[model samples]
Target chain A: MAMAAFRREGRRFAPLLHPNSITAPRSSLIPQELDPEGVRFISTQVVRNRMKSVKNIQKITKAMKMVAASKLRGVQTKAENSRGLWQPFTALLGDTPSIDVKKNVLVTISSDKGLCGGINSTSVKMSKAIHKLNSGPDKETKYVIVGEKAKAQLVRDSKKDIELNITDLQKIPLNYTQAIFLTLELVLVDKSSQAGLISVLADDILKNVEYDALRVVFNKFHSVVSFMPTMSTVLSPEVVEKEAEAGGRLEGLDSYEIEGGETKSEVLQNLTEFQFSSVLFNAVLENACSEMGARMSAMDSSSRNAGEMLDRLTLTYNRTRQASITTELIEIISGASALEG
Target chain B: MASNAAAVPFWRAAGMTYITYSNICANLVRNCLKEPYRSEAINREKVHFSVAKWVDGKPQKPRDEELWHGNHA
Candidate 1:
């Protein structure tokens, strides 16, 4: 078969980011390059240099893998805790599965760090698909890129659609404050289409950049090797209130007494914002965790491949070194024999 | 249900968005909680660093503004 054996093996054994790497590796030159004809001693030096470089690359990837693993451990707990915060709100809002959501902002959470395997691409791909599905003559879908990776990719195709893009989030550790600001930043971009207002802008489309709901696209961390791209829909409080009046799903909210100085609508809005912060917090944490997980796996494999390449190069170097030494010995012995004759 | 007595929330009447209302509520909730439990919750959840408004390709300097301003701080 014309296909490389590793292609089938990579598919069966490791269906991962290296699907592209399978096309052709440098080791394919082993047979042709090692051919004795026109072989020079300098070839040995070249192989040694490659072997040294591969060793260095392996060391870097191994260190990066360790870093990603530690980051994943640190972020996992926060993501879990934040998940609990949003559950109460979802119960209040009553997640009506079949409700058609139109005119919503798609907040895609992604890291610009290309080291994280295919996570950014996966999220961007899903966002594009959702945009295609939602955007039409009647409906509208605008993008609010939470991280720069999606912005970079989406800008190529959906330049006019991107309303806001925030970056520099993934390079540092994320906590509750960063997560909440990430949400609030959307509200701050007010009068002049500024960079500040996630909350205010979310109020309405006519005034600022407004939408009925927010479809948050992020990667949900499952484990070290598995992450699922997910979309969580958050509807505006007004929409939820309207739907509650018609659909009897929220009859339970009436049982509890909201005994604050503020009116019930004020309380509801507060709860909505509070609840959304939790969801946004959870999303950012989960996305970060998954990014680290993907990076860990990606770096681990890169390390392994580097090791394999080094081994092959070492073998070739030894063979070439020995071959050149033999050629020198043959030349000396034959010259002595010719002089004696 | 008191459908006849239904009144719009005061924050809405004041033209405040949910974000403002939530900030006010967070401040109030931190005030209502008792000691040890409150400290335990706040201390563990405290995030000290400030956030910079990311513009263009860089974060705006002098990011002195804290995203949250509540008793929890």
Candidate 2:
């Protein structure tokens, strides 16, 4: 036959092909069969190992959730207390008209730690969207990222625009001093003409933060389970003055005199600076609270998912064990019948 | 641009020395301090420097000596 002739010819021409033949011992292409008992044993070991690891992970996530929950209480109280100052001040500036500016500074507040679902990314996404809307030929938008995790994400989109990225802040609870120092640094970076000309503190820097309005984007904590990224704007005193002249909330301010013989402009400037820092502080605290809430929810879900996976794996393991036992019983019965025959 | 109404720098406006500003901020934080956070704010953490120079659009490590002395005299 033609097939026989082809095989003979192939063998004669390629004698080294014997190693790939079916009769060859331990050929790498062939899969060695596993006995039911062996299969069951391996599966049990694998499932046990997997279950143990998952249980450990579940424990870790549960602990983390509890920690975040406890921390949330303290952070929430701090944020609520500061609302007394921020609510009325922002109400006063509510009607201020937007100003046109060449440069705008956007401060995105987030936390360095992740494992919280979308907490950091929400701020980064909002920052990116705002930058996209505002970036133009005549306009330049600079970003001040508060968290390292967010900095890493936003850096990809706007490396140059990331004027400052503060990390290692999550180790401690955010305080007023941190907020003031951070605001001062932001003011310094936004200044185009000044470079080491002089050392400035809170007041001089506030003047230099010359945006028609300052915008802080952060995750606003809604409840123990919900948080959303929110944008809050702080209008400059200059803009507020203009708004006042145009019959805004401060229309009656001209009739009143500032205490201590301070000029109206002086008093307004101080108030504006105070409000700016206060707003920034509140945002930082709220973001901290949100981060904790997000972490708690995320870890809770993670723990639940792990539990589900463990259940499925255990069911599969039990089925595999039962199958192995059934196979052994059938083998024993067959052997006894063969002996009787 | 140089009007009498120009905004005075805070350090000049308040005539605050470096030590005074730190002391003031410390005292202010300590005044309204509550339990657990009180000790953390006052003892554990300290805000040493006021000004951080932004070099090439990044905050440089706040040079302690230069910040206090360079701004003073």
Candidate 3:
């Protein structure tokens, strides 16, 4: 990460070191080439200025590392707390019967910026692999990308069609409501359409149309140093139905029980929204946490590289200064001896 | 003292450029760890386990083995 920073700095600084800027003499004390003092002074000043700038950069990077670390800690806690909710939800899904549906949707979450390591690339590759595994030429495969980086990569490597491309979600509050809204807008447009009904009712909604299957591709945060790209499948309505038909009664299922003032369909709709919302929320949060972790690691490596460069440059500067002083001393001694002779 | 952001005119002047780069790198690592690397490893392990079942081989799950050896036995 530090390297990425350094490269960017180098690019920015390159233009500042133009011949016109560096070569123009600011002092009238001596000729440009013969005045070793002036040259040394200017060179040393430039080096010092550069070093100061780099030092400031290091400080900022360090602070950012700390911020990312704190955010990661908070996100991890949230993710853990939500796991309890996932258990009951998935259990309900398991109780549903399976059906034969023939479409797949993959919602991949990635980051907008680069330098965190291989997060975006990895996500794209995994999505491709999943697509390969689940989709045939005739099968309907669609994608809903969450981050800018993911969208760009998918677009570049697309051998199949993309159904939806969602960007700038980082600024939005990732919640169940947002998930429902997005799904409703993008995937659940036509109520009577097989794809729309299956997508809306199968995974999170109160088991409406049994979807063939639904999958989410995202990063799962493990620790500061470890994370993994994960693909989670929500049991489609068909699967639920099949399970229910095969001695798996839907009577006692969580979805079947209606709360006060809610019809069965209404309750199903709310649960559907909640389920979709949770999945989307989890994906976004996990991705954000992963981004922070990657940034931290990348910065750590960058700071180390900067330290190494500083060491080498300081050594070079010392040697050059020492050589110049030695030559001056030798010239002075020789002149004194000649005068005495 | 004036706030750093206010004092520094450009992003470079504020010395946030390095931070930006670091953030970028961190993002990359985070994404990579979550996506291809983690998924690939998990998928491979699943495939291996399936193959082991067919071949009558012992299924040595990494996490499970680590837990058993380090935490329990």
Winning model by DockQ = 2
Question: For residues B1-73, what per-residue lDDT tens digits would candidate 2 score against the true structure?
Answer: 1123346545534443233345355666565678777665464443442233344545555333113221222
TM-score leader: 2
- Give the better candidate number (2 or 3) by lDDT: 2
Among incorrect, acceptable, medium and high, the docking class of model 2 is: incorrect
Question: Distance from true position, residue A255, model 1, in Å?
Answer: 5.4
Report, for all candidates in order, the number of backbone clashes: 11, 0, 38
* Docking outcome class, model 1: incorrect
Cα lDDT tens digits, model 3, A177-198, are 3343344433342333322322
Q: DockQ of every model listed?
A: 0.13, 0.17, 0.01
Q: lDDT-based ranking, best first?
A: 1, 2, 3
Q: Which lDDT value does model 2 have at A138?
A: 89
Runs in model 3 deviating more than 4 A are A1-50, A94-101, A189-211, A243-273, B1-73
Give lDDT: candidate 2, residue B7: 61
Cα lDDT for residue A246, candidate 2: 79
Instruction: State residue A217's C-alpha deviation in candidate 2, in Å.
Output: 0.5
Q: What is the lDDT of residue B57 in candidate 2?
A: 48
Ranking 1 against 2 by lDDT, winner = 1
